[model samples]
Structures are given as structure tokens and as C-alpha cells.
Target: MNKNQDYEIFPDKFRIIMTGTTFAFFAIAIGAITLLRTNFVWKILAVIFAVLFMIAAVRIFKELWVKTPAYVINATGVTDNTQKVPVVVPWAEMMKIEMVPNNAVMQIGILAQKTVTSQTEKTHVLTKNLFTNGNMAFYSVMIDGFKYSKKHFLAIFEELQRQGVQHNPKILVSGYNVGREK
Candidate 1:
């Protein structure tokens, strides 16, 4: 158990910046390429997609500028601030924590006794029985390009689950090829 009960995981700014820049680049490239086309409907569709991507890029950059922790776990609960719809599930509500692999990404899926929602909004509970199909989670954190290693992040949660909280929620290891981590 760590001396400090609170664990805060910040996003890697460099990676975030790169991702945002890529989105922006694509938006510009797509819009520019479509300008050469004569089809009016195609141009409209391309412009819409470019605008959407630009919006996403702007949001990402804004989040990076804010510099908030992507994930936080403490004696009280686990808070996921990765998405626009932030969710905080207390230890008592959390039933299981699992490592769900989706392609090249490893996501920390927090399964609660019920659907966990944001303070204001009612977010959907996204899972189907132990997450066998790897559909979604009540709350999931993508562990790609974060400052810490996947093993370290998982270890922190495991330690917190064992020593920090009282409910003793199970932390299960799922998915294939779990040992590999960079």
C-alpha cells in the first residue's frame, strides 16, 4: 500500500498534442482535397466531417491545456475524467476492475454494481456479463500514451483495492497476452 492513499494519473501532453495535431491535419487535408471535386453533395459531406474532426481536435487541445488528471483513485472512489462525461464510482459501488484489451490498446474497465453516472448527466452502463465480448464498460480508461506504464497503473489500482477501500472489490485480469506491457 502506498503511503499516499490518493492516486492521480495525468495524461501525456506530448501524445495528446500529437493526436490533436493529427486530427487537425486530417481535417485540413480532407477539406482541401474535396475542394477540387465538382460534386456538391460530396463537398457538403466532406466539409461536415472536416468540421467534426476539427471540433474534436480543438477539444483535445483544450483538455491538454487544462492539464487535468485522466484518472484518479482515492479512499473515496475512482474518478474517470478522460471523456466529456466524467464518472465517479465509489468503492462500494464498484464490483470488479478488469484489464480489457481492444486491438493495440489496453483499457481499465470498471464494472459497478449498477450503471454509474456523472454528477449531472445519466450516462449509460456499458457492459454485458463480465465483459466477455469486450463491448464497453461503466467506466473505462484507455492506457495508451499515458505517463505511467500499464503494469504500474494496474498495480496501483490493485493496491488501492486491497488496502485503500473497505468493500474489497475484485480486480480480475482478463484478455489474452496480458503479460506484455511497454
Candidate 2:
């Protein structure tokens, strides 16, 4: 495969700040729970929340420590290296390419002509359901502002269009609107 360009979705200053804040919140919550004299049910809930938040904090910390490219878009296809098992979506199999607004960030959604398999499917039914979005099968790639600006992201989309894939202009516009609204 001819790898044309490589891009790294590095965490921006905003992301770093958010991650630090979340971690601090969780740490404080855990400490408060420990110090407070609560009922059994409340204690259990506190433990659960603490564990979940700790996990999330650890994940974010790992990402921050390990700086790697989240994805690699090549001449033939795009490969997602973020997951344990890399997902490679070939250009020929791409049915649609559009911008999807997610949590104040614009993500590039690549829908395949057929069902694309990934490591998540082997884990649980719920995971597969969440990833597939109940039949609308596609992969979402976050375009980090630190790594790529809107113009660069759009240029990449234009290049994909040149490869014969058509994107939904409405979706793209809506994504931009969402960014503006935020």
C-alpha cells in the first residue's frame, strides 16, 4: 500500500485542561466518599463511580503519555491504530464520507459499502451495537484541532471526493453549525 501522508491527532491544550480537571474531580470525589459516613447503598454507588472515573482518568493519562498517530490515511485506505485491533477501511469500499458533530468536535465519518468488522465485535453485543449505531455502520475519526485545522480536514475530504466518494453536504454543514453554536 502506498502511504501518502501521516497525521497525528495530538491532544490540544483544551484537551489537556479537560483531562486534568476530570482527573482532579474524580480524585476529590473519591476522597470525599472515603471521609464521609454514608449508608451502604451510597457507599457502593460511590465506589462504583470512583472506579469508573479512575479508569477514565487512567485512559486519558495513557493517551497523554503515549503520543501516537490516532489514524493513518493512505492512498488505498485509512487505518485506525487507536484500537487494539486496527481497522482498515479501503477507499473502494467507502460508500460515504461526511462530517459528524460529536461533543462539540467535528468528526469525519466513513461509511463502508459493506459491514466492516472490528475488535469490538468480539467483546460483547452491546459494544457491537454501540459501534455500529444500530445498523448505520460507519467509523468516526476525530480531527483534533492541534493536529488538523478545519481547512486541512476539508482538503482531506476533497481528496477523498476525488477518489469517487461522495459526502453529504448537509451533514458537513450541520457539523460546522454545531461547532459555531458551541
Candidate 3:
């Protein structure tokens, strides 16, 4: 690989990885609900869990779908297609970037702003406060349309670090679907 060449890691295998893991989990949860629905007392719990699983599955599907080119990353900053608007994180203000697990386990950082429902409107969902992220320092930017997980992601972050990105890298994530995967 040429040092001068700008490498764009596309999460080449992520789609396959997640489809098997996340989507499968959701399907299994749905299956469990079906299997347990026969029990009168447990039926309600099964139904609820199944619903939650289905919701999660749909989210995973949404996350895995990609309609853009490679994840554009460079010395200046990184850009993502998931973001509705363009986000430019200047290298000067760049802070540390790390990969984290998403879902309830850990807070998702460096990803698109999550959507929230509006309390004022009974039938409408509004954007939840995106600025107030969870206590967790960084969120793992989910890269879709891949067939695997570890390789490309690992390489991207290592490259960023090699380029001297420090922790809490000064980031400006004010965009529609911007994110990074390192």
C-alpha cells in the first residue's frame, strides 16, 4: 500500500457479520416468543420481548443497509453517509476515537443522532436531545454493507492513531448522518 494513498476502509464484511448475529438474535427472540406463547402467564412476557426483538431486528437491518461509497476518512477529518448533512471534524480539534459496542450495553458514539419520540405529540416521534449523549465517552460508528467485522475497522482506527489522534478527539458531529468507524 502506498503511504501517500488515501485509504478508505469500507467495513467490507460488516453486513454479513451483523446479519448473522443481530438479525439472527432478533429472529430467535421472535421464535422464542412463539414457542412460549402457549403458556397463559408467560405469553405476555413473550409477546413483549418478541416485540422488542423485532424492533431491534429492524434497527439492525436499517443499520446494515448502506447506500454510499466507502467511509470517507482523511487527514483533515472523516465523513459518513449515514449523516443527513455533512459533518467535518477538523484534524486540529480531533480527539481520541474508539470503537464501542452499541445496543443497551454501551452508548453509541460517533454515529448519527438517534431519533426520539415527541412527548408533546401523542402520535409523533421527535428528535430526542442528541447533544446530551450518554455518560459513555464515545460511540462506535456503525459501518454497513460489510461481509465481516474486525479487519477493516481495526485498520482504520490504527491508521487514525498512527496519524496522532488523541482521546476525546475534538469532534463536531453536527450533521444528518455523519459518523466514523475506528
Query: Which candidate achieves the best lDDT against the true structure?
Result: 1
Model 2 residue pairs with clashes: none
RMSD of each: 5.0, 6.0, 9.0
What does candidate 3's lDDT look like per residue over 60-174, in tens digits? 5554455564455666545544455444444554443444443322222343233223446312212222222333342323332233344454555556555433323444332
Whose TM-score is higher: candidate 1's or candidate 3's?
1
lDDT of 2 at 52: 79
TM-score of each: 0.66, 0.61, 0.49
Candidate 2: TM-score? Answer: 0.61
Worst 10 residues of 2 by lDDT: 166-175
C-alpha positional error of residue 32 in candidate 2 after TM-score superposition, expressed in Å: 0.7
Model 1, 1-182: lDDT tens digits are 47456677776577678889999999998788586947888888889989999998998888676667777777766777855766676776666666566555665566666444363343232432225335554444334324345666566556545633454535443433457654
Please list the C-alpha lDDT of all candidates, in the order they appear: 0.62, 0.55, 0.46
Candidate 1 residue pairs in backbone clash: none
lDDT of 2 at 93: 68
